[model samples]
Target chain A: MTSWMKKCLVVAASAAMTVGMTAIASADDVTLEFQQWWGVELPDGALQEIVDGFTQESGVAIELLSNPYADTKTQVAAGAATGTMADVVGLDGSWVYDFAKQEAIANLSELMEADGYDDSQLSDQIKYEGSTYMIPVVNFAYPLYVNLDILEEAGVEEIPTTWTEFMDACAKISENTDYAAYCIPLNTEAPNGIQNQFSSWLWASGGSLLKDGKPGLTDNELLANLVDYFKEMKENGYLSDGVEAMHEQDMVNEFENGRLAFMVDGISHLTTIKKESPDLNFTYAPMPKADDYDGKSGLDVACWGIGIAENCEHKEEAMAFIEYMMSPEVNAKLSQLANAFPGNSTAEPDYSENDELFLKAFEIFQDGYAINEFTGAPTAEDLMRSMNEQLILYFDGDTASVDDMLAATQEAWEAAYN
Target chain B: MNAKLKKKLTPYGYLLPTIILMMILLVIPIVMVIDYSLYDNVIANKNPVFVGLSNYAAVLKDSAFWTAVGHTLFFVIVSIAAHMIIGMVFALILNTRYLSTRTKGIFRAIYALPWMFTASVIAITWRMLLDPNGVLNYFILLFHLSPEKVTFLASRDIALQSVTLINIWSGYPFYMISILAGLQGISPDLYEAAALDGADAVHSFTGVTIPQLRPILISLIMLDFVWTLQQFALIWMTTGGGPVNATETVSTWIYKQGFTKFQYSMASTGAVILLIVCTIIGIFYVRHQKAEE
Candidate 1:
């Protein structure tokens, strides 16, 4: 061969080799998108720190997409519909059934088995049709928040433990104080109030809205009594005014401003309360139960659940990210930062440096079993909205009777489930 | 290849990109939505079965759907009527020769402030203002207007009217701006002639101004009627059709059915019904515009 030809061939060979090496390097540098609502809820930069830790431990990079809770749900749903969901999505338990049934989310059990992940370490996995779809990373329990100053000013001697005592306390508080005795946000705009606040009363008294995984609101006596309790509160002017328009944040704002005596709210609000109103004397305790019931109370819970999109390209890296987040140490830190309970059974968040209210809330959480019937239910938000509408009508004195309201709700829920 | 054919096809060539975009952005999605309405459990189901017009029948049969229809009619009718009156008043004020230009400019800006804020911002601001413990209530108490606080957006009796008022506030600016432009275009000689004919100010207004602005008024009413009928974000962010479906418009109902309830077929049915209604109004608007041209 001629010298010129040999030189040109040698340069082409070198270029090909360089291109191949670059391609290999880029193949290992995968960037997964993690979409979630936890970023705003947690301490600033906390979720980013968690993602950074995962990236550092593994070479897989993460792109964090954070939005408010409702916005995130809508975006994720839109993405799911369009087959463009993020690689790692923060799921709500209520969304699990629909997502799993649609095959929008990956089968987490298969992913765990494929990765040889210890599934036993998880305290809760949102499952549908015998397969897990979501792993809860942190749990927030809904307990009753009491304003001690309001109680004191109202001349209430002790915290109420039974329905009767609770009513008495509400009466005294309404009679003696300028503040309302209690507030339950029944706003249909974000109607999870029916789940977190209203249905919690029934759950606290060891009642179930589901019988054998179906709509069980037809003849549930506990539910009827719970409705009656709320009606009584309304009739006696014990409930805070304008509940029809109040949202969860509104209730928290009232409590923080000391205009409310009691509210059944998420324990995660403890941090917000302390930050917003440092002087507000408040404490978290278990929700009041029925006087005749002596069973284990079921505390309502919400969680920051994590799942992998079925359309994700890099399943291995996504599974690794999930494993990293669910590891005991990481889960504990996340729970602590979020002021919630760890989703890992063995992950005990260190509360030594945390607020005392959190510690007390943790104890209460451990004392009661975590339950939210709306979780993993079919069209959960619809159920909440239906019940919320019925209750609103009942409160407006537009419905015939409590039985009629419950019957209407039962019909609506059954229609949705079917 | 002929000159006549080339000239004819050239216009189509010029319009090809827009036609393609309309097909992709508007037509295809509408067709898909209609198709979805003919099926059961669309996006959430792996294999959806075609259910004919069963979904539409179900939506029509729902009491809540009828309630929403009633509320939507009330909302749209009230909003359009109020917007027209308010817009006319403001436009007249701004167009008045009695006022200085600087004063008119300031009043115009002040009146247009509500339109500057987005639906979400307006919803949040009004929510705070209408809360029982809100500033309005505080003022009411300070003046002893009532013994108790008024739940403006919370009461069943008044939530619909409250949202309607808010809609009017946010929407009147468009009508005002349009009517002002139309008013400016009217020939002053017409009013002078009316005055020479022994007409008073009121007579000049009704005889000259109203006739001159009739086309603009018709167009504004039609456009605002469609827009107000589909008002979702304000009502969604405000009451969410709450206080027991007092303000449940068709748009909010469709949103709940689709996004919240995961019933795509039902939502699409409701949307199709709304589309039909709007299409009817659109036909009228097109005919009116054509006749004016």
Candidate 2:
């Protein structure tokens, strides 16, 4: 070999040796293997970057695995039942309750304390059975998405915040344009655009599917009100001729193309709307007022939280990865990526580029309420989902009566809760 | 036969690899699917709880299951009828000698284009095309033909018929191609003899073409009937069994119940019922035809 070549070879060997040592340190030290269903969220090359960054800061080489929502839950349930789980998990909010009930999660209170999170900063709303089982990563609240074009076509100046005003607005919107006020979700499960569209109103009307561990059947007044309201919305031209038949994307297409006036959507839909048709005129507002708060504003929170699997071999590293994800920089980035907002309020992820309409969604959430503030489980939600299947007809004007629906809903809830 | 047999043992030894592969790829999955149909949950865990006929009973009890069955039966009957009638009609058109032979070939190829498209893309195109504010409706409104816009896919009463229309559109072209190939295979002497005897167009078809195409038609009907039972794409893309069970086919309902509602046992039960119903119909049709032959 030439003298110069020999010198270069030695330098290359030293660099390779340094890389080898770092890799070994990563493997041996506290490398945590984290699995998330959000493999989609990682983009083409983001996983490697996230892993490299996590390793550089903490000396822990992170291994990330991903699957879809259904597959992940099934796999996790099976794994936990058989005594195997990843160090960290990116669990959906609805599925977390079942996993927690099955004793699949690790308590993260101390980890949060170490990571500089406190109750004053984070909501106790995430606590279950007197323990914090997860760290809130991202959250989206259901809100009334109004196409300002439709409102203007109807000559309406403002979107209503209360139930009576919302109906009045709906009537006006229908009169002003051929647009249906809302759509109905036909299926018992799955994201039916129409059904979700109406759920916010019932929620805003000072009513819920459950009022304690029991069904909402006992409250004749609340039951009488919501069912009647939905019936009225259906009987009038506020809802489409038969919205119960439309799928989720149909509603999006309708709202996107200005076929309908208002849609109930989550914060995640904001990015989609902005990107899909940037020029569409619209705004996001708070869910209509439910009677319980009387004049107060509230939201139905759908927050995605991260949990540590109790079966994980590398708890500390996993905890570190979770904290890193919640770090202001990563939090904001992931939020923007997921079309959701940061769960932690201490550090606001960058919202500098948002127009007033886009920024106003987060502002509406400032006074938002949880879907079920007390319980962190998905059972009640599932229980309510079964009854909510009837909501399509409630929005379609074919319901026999509001009393009939309330009775059916109360019966379904009773069976579910029992 | 000797080569295939020899490949398995003599040359039949060469076929050993293929048999092993078939067992692994086809037989094993079929067996697993059957086993899963008998069990409660076979998705996540390799082992499943044996529920015997409970799943079957649940499926039988479900109103949606019956609705799905009715829809599937409806689609199969309509699609098969359309496929046979339209296919035969196109075959006749393609058999014409008025045009040059190459022009007939071109027309035959053009008729087969719908079959060439993937069922999914065909379904999605139809969905976009049929939407109330979609291209078709926009034009319909432009011409002022219909007083009101039609929600062909959005109304429960019409959603099934709408999806059936799309399925028939995709399916008939395929049958047209197959039956046209059969038309090509027929002896020219037979048609010439019938024509020399002064047979009319209808007479030539009934005496020669109809009798000759019987086996192909029956087989096509049987195969299409079974396949149509499993047509999830068209209905799923467009209606997804909504507007209150108007478009709920057996396969779609099985998927919705299994995946969406997480009712695996119930879904398996639905599948078994569909399988049994199709199998029974197939056997009856085949045997009745065999007896007649």
Candidate 3:
């Protein structure tokens, strides 16, 4: 080899060694991983931007593991089995109890106190059995959507606030227009889709799927009334003929195409509908109550929360990262970026100032009618899932009767919980 | 070590990697599943309490398990029959000497197109084509055949058949290629001999061709049976064991139990049952092969 070439090689090798040693020396003392299921969040790259900002402030590099919400729990379970779980996992607020029961996640009571996290500032959905297991991250409410053009064309001057009037309006809408009135979720494809939508009707009817930690399927008269109402709607052509196989996305498409008059969807869908159908005139309304039931009720709101895994090595560092993410300024920025509600009480979204459907949705959401029924009944996940599977059968006219569905569901629920 | 001992161990050394891989991938998972099936292991429960054969007993007694089995069997039987019939016809058509080499190659590629696509992609395509207002319904209406719309996948009585048809479409290509290979192996001299004996085409096909293809058919049928039993993605992507579990197969049901319901022990019990069923069929296939020999 040439002498100058050899000398250049030696110089390059020494420079590489110095750079490697510097990186090793400057490595953070504790590196935490954050696993979340918001890969499809609005304002793409906002999550990574927020994480970068957090890293800059805390100097504790956080690795973000993103997945879809449907597969997040399964991934977490597999990770737990292999002892490679992420330090912080973003979970559905409804699943806090399930994870707590398994002891898969750590109790964050001490960390919250140490970080001066006021529980009152967060939503009630993150608490389980008088203990805080997760800190609320994002909140969403499912409200009814009404096509104003369809209502005006149908001569429906007033929006229905009771089940009787609601059914009457549906019949009138069908009579006036060629489109159906409502897209009942006879086949939501996903259990959560049906569970979240059904809970609204169940709550509006002054009933719940569970009572005192037991199955309330057969015991609740309002549930029977709810089933009868569903049957009546189907029998009267108020629902689509293909309702037996319609999923949430299909329903949204139908609504956008002017084939349906109403649907129950997340407030985040407001942005999607506006973008997809720029000229469509649609408005949001609170879920209606039953005629006999004079109580306020709304759909169960689904929210996201961050929890510390039980096997997390850097609990203090993880809590610090979470504290940075939940700071009022950062939280508000995230809410604005993602078009989501603020997770902290002190950081309210400015949607109320806008003269749009979102403002009405925000009003209805905070009007005290919408309760976090998912948290109200810790066992609602299993109970409602079982009901969703069996009740769809009844709705398809496969089962003998609503009575049979009630009996079978109550039996299955007893077997499951017992 | 002695030369004889070293020689004996040499073959095993060559196989050592594969043996270890099988033990890790196959044996360990089977053992874990069997162990899990004997315990009450909900995903939320930190510790699994031993329940002995109660999980198996529960599975045996559950009516839903039987319904899933029945649906799975119906799908398998119908799909396999359609695959064999259509595959044999296409194989025969391609095996004909009258066809040019380029034409044969084109036909083969056309037949193999479905196999090139993933099951999910095929399922989504079929879903769109079979939707209530989908292309098929559009054609049906254009012809003014039926005054009412045909709900192929939404109807309880028709969803299973719809999914079965899709499975048949996705699976028939494998059988066609196998049968075509078997046909190509049969000597042309045999057909000449049969012609000399005044044996017609039908007699030759039934006697010579059928007998020569027996072994290949047996092996392919057994493999097809097992594959159909474990089919998941297509049906899951399409019906999701819904329209009231009318299309619920054992595999989809197992997935629902484990992932959706978090009933790990129950799902494991179902998996063990599937394993036993497959093992029994495999043993019978081996015995049948021996009997044929």
Candidate 4:
């Protein structure tokens, strides 16, 4: 070998060795607790397997603990006070206010900047107190999930195109079959998992959350009238027996059992139905409008979001972990689990990588059949959850008239606001 | 005495482990509850801000809190009375040897079914039976007893009573089982001796049977009273403390305030009031027992 060539080879070999060690030493190891409510539909710890790849790449260990449904908020509170909050936490979008009231969340603007989560992607509609506190995970729009098998079996060729036709169709389904037209769990929390669907109903019926682009939650003629119609629908056997106060899954189960023709519920439930009863033939449709702009008029959406706790000891690590979660590749891995549609627009693979019921949810989102007031005037949510609760009374025969229900509800709304 | 002292201490030593467990499990949570009760501890947020005795004062002034207390007390009084009366009556009938012990045992087992059933299932079962088109309504119509469906649980006046019926049904077997054990403890000779004196059923019940069963009855009634007072699930599951708050009990109200409304301060206030009411009742119970001693 020439002496000059040998010297060059020796220098290159030493440089390559130094570069390999530098790469090895730079990867820091850290563990993050990721808190969420674990449910049957969560797919046997599918999320853990999904996040594990991110840990492998980033060298950050993600320890997952599925908090119980009702106790999650309290557990998070305790976790925060003791400096034990999961660095990244999942919460029901509806619960954002209660958490925000306590400042249980880390100020996200700082973290979002470092994580490359910018404010421009979040609409002003979702901002709270002039700041966006949520990173949306699953954007759930309430829609009617019809057992197409039963609808077609009844010789019904078309889904109802309008609100009146929908009720008429329900009447036909009720008469022709043992199935009651719809199953509405009159006594459930957030009645039927999306009383937001009722808001969609109101929108279709010429009512809006507001007349203008503001929170017109109350003092709307059309909205109040929509409540009246909702009560009447309950009274007239449009909503079935043994349904009031039934849990959401039981409502879906009754549908799967072919006992109900229609079930109005969340978009996230697409995977739920497929896993729980794959044999059931169901199709999703936005609530039909009585007028052109009802559902199309405005949007109602709720999504589970993760926020950094305010006092996380490892704040930077938490932000890094959140940024990793939003990465296109990492989100794709989690999306493959089909627990939720990932927050990233570019991360659609987490949703579309599979060809199961998860595809159905994405299809609806693609069709623009979704809306959510993820953040709005605070009083709107309390009013919405409550009026739905009162809707149960109309089914129970506790009130002789819809006016009675509305008057009482208005009193409740006024009381809540007052 | 010194030897005896060590033997008694041995049982306490055995109890030491349980005491530690109770302190860790029950006492600590209770102490935390008391601590949280003194402040407004919003989950994961604001440091607990102590506003001493205000939660208690606020709960005292809130009419809804008082209404819940009234409903809870009403449930306890009515349920305990029904359980004691029905339980004592069942015990008296079964006390006789007209039926063999084996036959009596089968009957007891049959009646014991509801007690063994879960509270949630019991609530759901009763709700169905009481619904307008439910079994009870079907029977009522078939017999032409009432012109229309009662809608028993939907009516404000009827909802509390409807749940009380279920509560009585859920509770009687436990009381009967307890009083039956008390019944067996009474010497058969007392009944034989009473029979020799030609004491009729009523005469013996007022005299010998009642006196012998008094201690167990007191204890049983007190326990049932407390249980019924704390009752939430059955009423909540069935009626959701609704029909315009007629069935709203203190426990459900606390849950609604604390968890549903996120008003931990308000829930704490309600808790303090509930504790006070329970403590007052407990004092009366202890005094009653002391007088008997």
Candidate 5:
């Protein structure tokens, strides 16, 4: 070989090594992508505020990816298959168990312990088999949100706390007003929403959808009673005739428009209602119980939390962002901004700034959560979804008996679980 | 390389990228779907356990699957019938001899408006218009047609038909355009010749027009049926196969099993079944085309 050729080869190798090392060094500073579903629903710039606060504290640039709630599962599933999931993503409470069981999400028990964070800081609903997969960041209970003015027009003096009174009030509203007395979201597009709404009623009647971590609809007398009660209500025209097609959002819009006397909705819907109609007089009441029950409401709690993907390359940075967001101050601020219940135990929503009507609604949430029996099961969401599909027949004015519905539900559950 | 071998290899060299792309995009995924259909993977990211034909057996035995197939078939039959009947009417109207070419073009473009919009957009628009308090009910009330609002998409008896109506409205344009093209191709001399034979408008339509349009109608109907079976966004957005699974179709059921319930293997089994159905339809289409020739 010529001397000049050998010299050129050595020079080229040196340059290539230097560029490679520089590229590797540049990749050390991590950027974390955070995927969530709240962007469009949240107040303008609210997500950016949280992202900005986290980025300032952790110095990790966050790429916020907002997916619609309906498409989150599909996107996450696709991401998992492609090994391209975001570093951190917010997941619904129902997803925690499935994601963790499949190791799609990173188990954060060690990370939490190392950071001096315990389960108490977040809700226990996110734990699957006693392992933490997500840090609870927002939690809320479903309640019967009422348009107080509509009730007044119907000459109803107070919100109902028992099933008998609730039905009576609904009848009064129907007779006296142009509005539907109560709105039932029977939209099958979101079987989860329908299931959650129905569970509150089931629980209010002192029934549980799950018995021994499997579906228990067959022998659950209270559930049967609830179905019968719903049938009677539908017969009396207290529920909307359009219930079969209306989604939870549609019902929420009706409530805001004063066309619905009562709607079973989450606390976060308050933010949207307020934005749309600031003068609308609305209040939240404990979901009514069955006539024989001891007047205990069975409002179920749903939690929203953030989890790191199992393959996240920036786990430390993602954890830091989560820690910053879950701090009491930020958590409380986000909760207040979204009108949601704070997931952090130390943080409390400030309702003192609101008017009397708003205060009444906020106070019901402050009374604490109801019995949540389904959270412990790994397949709680699917099992309930199966039952919801069957129960919707009755809810949609199908002539199926309580026995038939229960049998169908039992069949569906066995199909899912077995 | 030898001249003969080089010449023979040139065509394949040009086709290599497309062949590889097809293998990667289509053939491999289909194989994977078939492989997955034989496994018992319910949870995401978990190693699938081999289960042979168990997934298929379970799906075939499940009543919900049959219900979904029934619903899907209902939707397909109703949608295709409407598309053809209405589309033929529109095509005949546009093909009228009295209409100017410019007027025909303008009317055709206007009739194709629904085709310009995405299925999701059409679904949402129709949903808003059909809401209980929406414009349709408002007009119905305005005319004192009914004392109460009609729950068009919400009622069990009507939800499937409501979705089918929407699909027909959205899909008929394609048939209209295709059939119109087919009508335009038929020589006007044949119509004049039929006229000289004393055949009236009705006879000409049933005899020459129908026979001439048979090939296009058959192809369009087959394609429309397959597409309707796969209709997801419209039903998903409108009724979500709801009011007691009244609108549930096979595609939406697969979505529920795969995305919502995380039963990947069961979903794959459903997909494989749909593939078999589509393949059968394709075979019929090919044989029908050959017979027509």
Candidate 6:
């Protein structure tokens, strides 16, 4: 062989060995695969920046596996089924019960105690069978969004605070204006519409959906009143049309385009509404309550919850990442970026520089206690869907009465719960 | 080994890879699903109990399952019938000698446009077009057809029909292309012979055209039946089997059971029921194909 060819071969072999060793060294470093829907929802690189910060501080890398919300649920469920779940996962609060029952997720209480984590600082932790399975990282409260232009055009002089006043305003808006007075998305495709928008009315009136941790629809007069209120809206043409096919995004779009006067929506949408419709004059208010109610209203809330998989190889590292996310400063930063409330009781997001509507919503949030009965409920989506179907029947006048509707829903929920 | 034995085994050896793939991908999963249907709380519970035929019994007794069956039948029948009619009409139009080659090409491209888009795009596009405040409503208002907007997808009365229509629109192109090929392959001599016999256009179509297209028609119907029976994405993205179970086909019901409700055993039971129906249709289809051959 020629001398120069022999030298070239030796140089290439050395380079290959060096690259292989580097790869092996990198492989040894703990890298957590964090699957979530937040990456697409947040500002580009915001989640990545948070993870990068953690990596820099803790010397543990995080691989973000992000998909859309529904897709994420499916992927995580599939992963759990196959015992291949990522080290860290973003959970919907509704999924906690099923995952815990299946033993797909680790008990966070044990992990926290082992790590000496301060559990008292956490605002909400999803529990199943007396064990913490997931911790909420951020919360998005559903508050009523009012369009000022629509109110003025409809000659509504005041924002409604009670059921009676709200009905009067809706009637005025329907009779005097081209736009609908209110919208309640009843789409069963993503049936959370029922949980978030529809049932919030009952909650806002200080009503309960559970009786001793069981379905209470049949005996709950407040639920009947809520159903009657919506039925009346449908009859008066005050409710937006085509709601049966409308998802949350559709509801948001209608409000953004000035076609809807009032809607209860997630606070996270404030940023999108501000950006998409810069000239939209809108304000946030607590969801209107029943005329006779004087108790503290329960505002509906959804959260970006986090959990560790039971199958995770690095439980300590996963817990560390969760702790990093829940730390006061980082939680506040995440809340601000996501336009949501911090899940840490001591962490307060600075809304001074955010959209004024966010600050208003935060004030409204403080006035009411956050409540979502579906969280940690078994087959929550199915329960919501059952109620949604009954509601649709009631609205269509196919069901005889609200009592019958509730009775049917109660039966369905009983079947599901058992 | 003997030379004759080796020769006899050559074809089986050639098919080994495909047989193994089918065993792994198709046969094994199907077997697992069937096994799951016989159990209670299969995937969601770590220790699933074998419940015999109870899941099947539960599904059969459920009113929702029957409603889904009715919806699926309506959706499949109407979709297949419309697809055949529309496909045959377009195929005949394109085959007519009156149109120039260039014009036929343009028309064919236009006719085939719906098939080019993905299900998601088709669903979103149709959703906007059929929305209450959408262009369709705008046109209806302009023409004073009705005093108010028509909620095409949201109305329980019309949601099933609307989704069926959308399915027909997206699916007819396949039928049209297949039938167009069948038309081109038919001997011109038959038509010429019919013309010489003083056969009118109607008679020629019935006697010559229909007979020649019979095989293709049967094939298209069988194939389209199977495809439409399993239709999920378009309906899911459009109405989600709603306005309250108006469009709740079996496929959507199975999806809700498994994915949304985490009732994997029930979902498997529903799926097994669907599979049995499809397997029956598939047998007929295979028989028809073999007869043609």
Give the per-residue lDDT of model 1 (tens digit) for B137-253: 999999999999999888989999999999999999998999999999999999999989999989998999999999999999999999999999999999989877888999999
Alpha-carbon runs more than 4 Å astray in model 6: A1-27, B1-14
**How would you encode candidate 2's per-residue C-alpha lDDT over A222-298 as one tens digit per residue?**
65676677767777767764455455666777788777888887766676677788888888887777545575444
Regions of model 5 farther than 4 Å from truth: A1-27, A81-83, A114-119, A123-125, A202-207, A211-221, A291-298, A348-358, A374-376, A395-404, A407-411, A414-418, B1-5, B42-45, B139-148, B284-293
- State, as a TM-score between 0 and 1, how close model 3 is to the true structure: 0.90
DockQ-best of 2 and 5: 5
DockQ of each: 0.68, 0.20, 0.38, 0.14, 0.61, 0.73
* Stronger candidate by DockQ (4 vs 6): 6
Task: State chain A's TM-score for model 1.
Answer: 0.95
Query: Backbone clashes per model, in order?
Result: 0, 25, 0, 13, 2, 0
Off by over 4 Å in 1: A1-26, B1-13
Q: What is the C-alpha local distance difference test score of each model?
A: 0.91, 0.71, 0.79, 0.68, 0.80, 0.93
Q: What is the per-residue lDDT of model 4 for residues A220-332, given as tens digits with 9 covering 90 to 100?
A: 66666666665566666666554544556557767776777787776656666676777888887656666444334333556666788776667777777766766666665
Per-candidate chain B TM: 0.96, 0.87, 0.95, 0.89, 0.96, 0.97
TM-score of each: 0.95, 0.80, 0.90, 0.80, 0.91, 0.95
Ranking by DockQ: 6, 1, 5, 3, 2, 4
Could you tell which candidate, 2 or 5, scores higher by lDDT?
5
Model 4 bad stretches (over 4 Å)? A1-31, A71-87, A114-127, A149-157, A188-194, A203-207, A210-215, A271-281, A292-300, A350-361, A374-382, A389-418, B1-61, B89-159, B243-246, B291-293
TM-score of predicted chain A against the true chain A, for each candidate: 0.95, 0.78, 0.86, 0.79, 0.89, 0.93
Clashing pairs in 3: none
Model 5: lDDT of residue A54: 73
> Over the stretch B1-293, how does candidate 4's per-residue lDDT look in tens digits?
59989988998998999999999998886677777778865452367788887777777888988898888878888899999888877876676789998988888888778899898899878876886657998999899999866767766677788888999999999888898898889997997899999999888878788899988888787777777888888987787776547677898888777655667667766776667767787887899889988
Q: Which residue window of length 10 is worst by lDDT in model 1 chain B?
A: B256-265
lDDT of 5 by residue, A29-131 (tens): 5678888887766877889888887777666788888877877766876666556878898887767676777788887887777767655766443676677
- Reference-based TM-score, model 5: 0.91
